[model samples]
Target chain A: MNLTILGCYAATPRTFTNPTSQVLEIRNRLFLIDCGEGTQVQLRKNKIKFSAINHIFISHLHGDHFYGLIGLISTFNLLNRNNDLTVYGPKGIQEIIKLQLKLSNSWPQYDLHFVELTSTESEIIFEDDKVIVKTIPLKHRVYTNGFLFQEKIKERKLNVNAVQNYEIETCYFQNIKSGKDITLEDGRVIPNSELTFDPEAPKSYAFCSDTMYNEEIIPIIKNVDVLYHETTFLESEVELAKKTMHSTAKEAARIALQANCKQLILGHYSTRYESIKLFKEEAQTIFENAVLGDDGKVFEL
Target chain B: MNLTILGCYAATPRTFTNPTSQVLEIRNRLFLIDCGEGTQVQLRKNKIKFSAINHIFISHLHGDHFYGLIGLISTFNLLNRNNDLTVYGPKGIQEIIKLQLKLSNSWPQYDLHFVELTSTESEIIFEDDKVIVKTIPLKHRVYTNGFLFQEKIKERKLNVNAVQNYEIETCYFQNIKSGKDITLEDGRVIPNSELTFDPEAPKSYAFCSDTMYNEEIIPIIKNVDVLYHETTFLESEVELAKKTMHSTAKEAARIALQANCKQLILGHYSTRYESIKLFKEEAQTIFENAVLGDDGKVFEL
Candidate 1:
C-alpha cells in the first residue's frame, strides 16, 4: 500500500501550506481522503491521474476539508469523464454540491453517486473484497468522523520447495492456497500449512483530524500500521486546543501511544507555527515513531 | 482608473491561464469582478490587499465566473475579518451562499450583504459620491447582466494660484469648486470657470462577459472609456459561440465599436486556442483599439 500526501496543513490554505488531503493506493484502488480547497491543483502538481480516483472519503463538511470537491467534480465533467464517481461524506455534502450545479446550470455527464453518512455510531462505511473502511467517531465542535482503512488478508502463498517434494498436482494449488488439505493420487492426505506459507499480514491506516484528544477511538484504530492525527496546537496551547476542539501535539502523541500504532504521522499544524519540527519533537517525546506530515510526501506500507 | 486582470481566459482554469476575473481600482476603491476558481490564490500571488476589496460584483452564476466566491468569503471569515462585505450578483446568489454557510455551520462574524439584481433593464445597483455602478442586461443562457462602473466627476480644482492672485477668501473656495459664482468680501463676483479648471472627466469601464452578440446593450454602455467583452471563440467557431451563448472576437469588437468605447479589451478566450494573439488580430479587423486581455496584465484607463 502506498499513501500520497497532497496537503497536510491545518486551517486556511496558504501559498506554502494546504489543508488536509491525501491519496491512498491499496490493492490497485485509489481512495481520496478529505479533498480540501485547491486539491485539483495539488493533484496536478503531484502527477496523480485524476480518473484513477474512483472513491472519495470526506471526514467532515468544514470548508477547508471539502470545499474543492464541487470544483473538482465540475472539472471532471469539463474533461468529459464518463466513469461513475462515488462520494462518501457527511449528510449535507450532497446538498452543497447539488446547489452549486443548480446555480451554474451545469451537470456532469457521468454518473455521480453520493453515500451520505448520518450514523453517529462507528460502522463500516465501505467494503470490498480486499479493503474495508470504518468510521472512527471523534469529538469535535461539529459532527465529524475519522476513517480507518484496513486491507483484508490475502490468500496463502505457495511453498515451492514443499510442493516439489510432495507430488502436488498443479490443479490442486488453488485449493492449497485456500488453506484446504488436498488428497494426492497416492491416497495420502497433505496438510495445507505444510504445502503453503502464511499470507503476509494486512496493513491498515487511520486518518483522524479536526478533533480533540479522545481515547474512545483507540480501540477502533489500535495497532494500525500508520495513524494520521491532527496536531493543531503545541503543548503551550493545550487550553486553546481544548476550547477549539482541536488536539495539541502532545495530546495526539498520547493517543498514538495508546493506540500502539507502528508509525504516527502528525499533521494539520496550526498556521501560527512557522515550522512543524516542534510538533514532531513534541510527539516523539511520547511516541518514538512520530513523523511530521508534509505536502507531497508519500509513504509506503 | 486602473484595471488589473487577475484572469481572463475562458472555460476552465489551466496551469498558465485562468478563467474570468479582474480588479478595477477607481477612486481608491477596489472592485472585484467575476471571481472564478483560484481567484484567492491569484490575489495572493498578485499581492493584493484583502482589506482593500470592500465590494464584489459577479457578472453571472456561471462556474467559471464565480466559483471562487465561496472560498474567498470563507477565507475572509477565517481571517477574522470584521468589515462588512457587499456582494452584488443575480438573484439566487444569496441562497447559494447561505446554504454553504449552513452546511459548514459557520456564520461570519462580519456582516455579509447581498444585492440581488432582477431588473431586465438598465438600473443603477450601487451609487456613491465618487462612483456609480449600473447593470447592463445582456442576452445569455442564464439570467445575466454586464456591469458598468463609472467614476463620478471629481470636484472642481481649488485653483490655488487663482484664489491667491484674486484675493479670494478661503470660505468661498468651496462654492467656487462647486461651479457656483462666488461673491468675495470685496464685493467682486468671481465666475466659477475663472476660479477653477474643469474637474477630471468621469472615466467609465463596462464589463460584458458570457453573453451572445447583443447590440442592445450598446446604448446602456455608450461611450465608456473601456469595454471588456467576452470573446470565447474565433470567427471560425462562430457556430459554437452561438450554441454556447458566447461571442466571437469579431462580434465582441463590433459591439464595442457600436458602443463607441475608447478601448476594447477582449477576454474570455476559449481554452482550445493557445495563443491570444489571434483574438486581438481578429478584433482589430473590426475595432482598431482592441487589445487582448491577459492574466496579471494591468490596463490604465
Candidate 2:
C-alpha cells in the first residue's frame, strides 16, 4: 500500500501549502480523499495521472475539504475521460457539483456516480475481492466521515517443495492453498499446513480529519496499521481547537494511542503555526510513532 | 490604470500555466475578473491583498472562467473580511455561488451582492465618478461579456502659479477646477483655459476573453488605450478555435486592429503550444502593438 499527500494544511491554500487532499493506492488502485482547492494542480505537480483517480472520498462539505470537486470534475470532462468515476461524499456534495456543471453547461461524457453519505455509523461503502472501504463517523461542525481502507486476507501460499515431496497432485494444490486437507489417491490425508505456508498479514489504514477530539471513533479505527488524524493546532491552542471543532496535536496523539494504531500521521495543520515540526513534537508526547504529514510526502507500507 | 494577469492560459490549469483570472486596479480600487481554479493561490503569489478586491466580474459561467469564485469567497469568510463584495456575471452565477455556500453552511459575514446579467447588448454594469465599466457583448459557447473599463474624463488640473498670480480665493478653486472661469471682485472674468491646464487624457482598458473572432465588439471597444483579448489558438488551429468558440492569435489581432486599440494584450493561450511567444508573433503580424500576456505579467496604462 502507498499513500501520497498532495496537500496537508488547514483553512485556505497558500503559496507553499495546500488545503487537504491525498491519494491512497491500495492493491494497485488509487483512491482520492478530501479534494481541497488546487487539488488538480497539486496532482499535476506530483506527476499523478488524472486518469488513475477512479474513486474520490470527501470528508465533509467544507470548502477546505471539497471545494476542488467541481473543478476536478470539469477537468476530467475537458480531458475527454470515458471511464466511470465515483464520488463518496456528504449528502449535499452531489447537488453542489451538479449545480456547477449545469451552470457551466459542461457535463461529463463519462458515467459519474455519487454515493451521498449521511450515515452516522461505521458501514461499508466499497468492497471488492482484494479490499474493503468503510466509513468512520467523525465529530465535526458539519456532517463528516472518515474512511477506513482494509486489505482482505490473502490465500495461503503454496510450499512447492513440501507439496512435491508429499506427492500432492495438481488438483489438490488448490485445496491446500485454501487451507483444506489434501486427500491422496491412496486414501491418505495430508494436513494443509504441511503443504502450504501462512500468507502475509493484511494491512489497514484509517483517515480521519477536520474533526474534534472525539474518542467515539477509537472503536471504529482500532488496530489499524496506520492512522492519519488532523492536528489543526498544538496543545497551546487546545482551547481554540475545541471551540472550532478541531483537534490539537496532543489530542490526536491521545486518540491514536488509545486506538492502538501502529503509526500516527498528523496533518491538516492550521496555517497560523510557524512550523509543522511543532505538531509532530507535541503528538510524540503521547504516541511514540507520530510523524508529520507534509504536502507531497509519500508512505509505502 | 494597473492590470495584473494572475492567470492567462486557456482550458485547464497545468503545473506551470494557470487558467483565466486577472486583477484590474482602477482609481485605486481592485476589481477581480474571471477567477479560475487556483486563483487565490495565484493572488497570494502575486501579493495582491484579498481585502482590496471589492468587485468581481465573471465573463461567463465556464469552469475555466469562474470555478475559483466559491473557494475565494469561502476564504474571505475565513479571513473575516467585513467589506462588501459585489459580483457581476451571467444570470445563473448567483445561484451557483449561493448554493455552494448554503451546502457548506459558510455564509459570508459581509454583505454579498450579485448583479445577474442576461442582456445580449452592451450596457453599463458599473459606474463611479472616476470610472465607468460597461459590458462588451461577445459570441462564445455560453453567454459571455467583455468588460470595458474607461476612466472618466478627469477634472482640469489647477495651474497653481496662475491661480496664485490671479489671487484666486480658495473658495473659488473648485469652480476653477470644474472649468468655470473665475470672476474677480472687480467683475473681470478670467478665462478658464488661462487658469488651468487640461488633465492627462483619461485612459481606458477593455478585457475580452473566451470569445470567438467576432467584429460585433468593435464599436464597444473602439479606440481603447489597451485591449486584452483571448488568443486561445494559433492561426494554424483556426478550425479548432471556431469549433471551440475561441479566438486565434491572428484573429485576436484582427479584432484589435479593427477596433483601433492602442495596445493589444494577447492572453488565454492554449497549453498545447510549446512557446507562448508564437502568439505574439502571429498577433503582431496583423497588429503592431500586440504583446503576449503571461501569468503574473503586469501592465500600467
Q: Quantify all predictions' global Cα lDDT against the true fold.
A: 0.90, 0.93
**Tens digit of lDDT per residue, candidate 2, span B166-230?**
89889998999999998898999999999999999999999998899999999999999999999
Q: Model 2 off-target regions past 4 Å?
A: none
Best by TM-score: 2
Worst 10 residues of 2 chain B by lDDT: B97-106
State the RMSD for candidate 1.
Answer: 1.8
Q: Distance from true position, residue A55, model 2, in Å? A: 0.4
* Chain A TM-score, each candidate: 0.98, 0.98
Query: In model 2, which residue pairs have backbone atoms overlapping below 3 Å?
Result: none
User: How many backbone clashes does every candidate have?
Assistant: 0, 0
lDDT of 2 at A220: 92
- Please name the candidate that would achieve the greatest DockQ relative to the true structure: 2
lDDT of 1 by residue, A209-255 (tens): 87999999999999999999999999999999999999999999999
Name the regions of candidate 1 deviating beyond 4 angstroms.
B161-166, B183-190
Q: Clashes in model 1: which pairs?
A: none
